[model samples]
Target chain A: MGEGMIQDQSDEDLMKAVAKANQSAFRTLVNRHMGRANTIAMRSLPRREDAEEAVQDSFCKIWVNAASFDPDKAKFMTWFVRILTNTCLDKIRSNPPRAGDIDALADVLADDAASYDAQYGQKREGEAIRKAVQTLPDRQRMAVILCYFEEMTNPQAAEVLGINVKALEGLLVRARRDLKGRLGAGEDNDG
Target chain B: MTDDDLKKRLRAWTVPAPDSGLADRIVMNALRHPQKMPWSLRLGKTLETWLLDWNAGAIYKCASLAMIVVIGLSIGYSSPYAGGADTISIVDLAMGGMNEWEGS
Candidate 1:
């Protein structure tokens, strides 16, 4: 392809080509988004294996539905994240985690804080923050995870949760207030 | 601290890295069974390409013409003119009676 033609091929164009069974175009799109999708899935789903499956499912869904994707409704990344998050959430809800699993996660969080602080030399504050986040209400915790850990924008996070942008903002606000209160910060702490 | 600051700190806390090879497995699976194109889309593209083919276009035109000719022949066979002369004789008798009645 000529440089001009290549320049004109946006992600949407590539997706359209993939819909026509263009292998190279499909590969390019998969390679570009796979890491991000995997990250989001892993964060949302309780099990690593389930997360991987969800990511794969999301990619397949994207491929089948590529032609129907409306650029007017959302950016490609946002749309992709929405699919990934929803897939993970569906899997998680279908198979609730075992009691031991929740405990295992709490242990993992503690270990993570220790190791990260050891490597970076920021101990007390990291531990405090982790504890505060862990104490957040389940919905607030999910919102914080999707918004912060998964790096999703507010609108995209809202889409994943099936809520409007304003609702998402309220959730975030309440989450922040709760976290600050749990951390022994007064209401005026603003976090 | 600001909420953003707290968020930054929370992000620093260790979330387990997903199991290794997940990405590779996903990509391989995707490559093995790429999404099946919608049936409608596949059918439409096939029709479009078939219509664009010269031989297909010629065949289509010939079939259309054949259809038109068959319809024309059927219409001709069923036409009023194709009815026997007895029907015309009946009409003429009815017309003659009407004329006589009008004259009287």
Candidate 2:
């Protein structure tokens, strides 16, 4: 199909084309979702190499399992996020992030003391929040990532996690508490 | 910091852009190594690959030996022709000497 023609199709149509080894469809899908995938991976893994590997592995899985996608079960982003999240989680499980690694990453992200970055304080807070998030138990981290960072609704996030909505809410509650305890934040919004 | 402040910071913190070639790289890698269908079959294939080093031939040999031992015992103890000297011995069955019984 022509590039313009392929661009006119929806994600589900693109995925079906991908199942048939349509490289153009696959490229379109990659272009469509790569940024979100990169953000999820970069946030979760916090290291360039691991995050890159996770995203690559996820897209690879998506390519292979395109045919298995049941639209009734999940939208394309949900399914894709689930894969990316699982890949990041696997990376997390295998290579438990060290404290020094987090600090080093924060320093790297901090970058350039001389660059009059007005959001320096905000950036620092972001790093601290990420650090606190890192300290969370794996499931709690996932809950925060999906519900908060990815901005998924409770049911949608739960669907991706393969957990019930109630359980997912429970995770979020506990996660908020954990983050509160660790960061001295989340007071008014503790619910 | 206020809760909203933290939330705003969370929203604002975007990781720097990764390499421009990433999407292309991912697509190429995926095309090169397409996923297999039906997880169960893939799992079975993976298990087969992993367990290939366990010497399955030895297992088959052991199973054959067990069957031979069972047949030997059944035939020796449960012979139907107990009184006839012309009845084939267990040795005849073992050594393919049952042709003599056919002649008789």
Off by over 4 Å in 1: A1-10, A105-142, A150-152, A159-162, A181-191, B14-20, B38-43, B53-69, B83-104
What DockQ, between 0 and 1, does each candidate earn? 0.32, 0.35
**Top of the candidates by TM-score:** 2
Model 1 per-residue lDDT tens digits across residues B1-104: 68777776666555445456655666567666646656777889789877787676687789998999999989977977665646778799899999999999
TM-score of 1: 0.68
- Shift in Å, residue B90, candidate 1: 22
User: For candidate 1 chain A, which ten residues in a row score worst on lDDT?
Assistant: A119-128
Report the lDDT tens digits of candidate 2 across residue range A103-181: 8877875784326566665666677777878778888888888888888999999989889999998988887777766
Q: What DockQ does candidate 2 have relative to the true complex?
A: 0.35
Indicate the TM-score of model 2. 0.72
Candidate 2 segments whose C-alpha is farther than 4 A from its true place: A185-191, B1-6, B39-104
TM-score of chain B of each: 0.45, 0.32
Interface RMSD of each: 3.6, 2.1
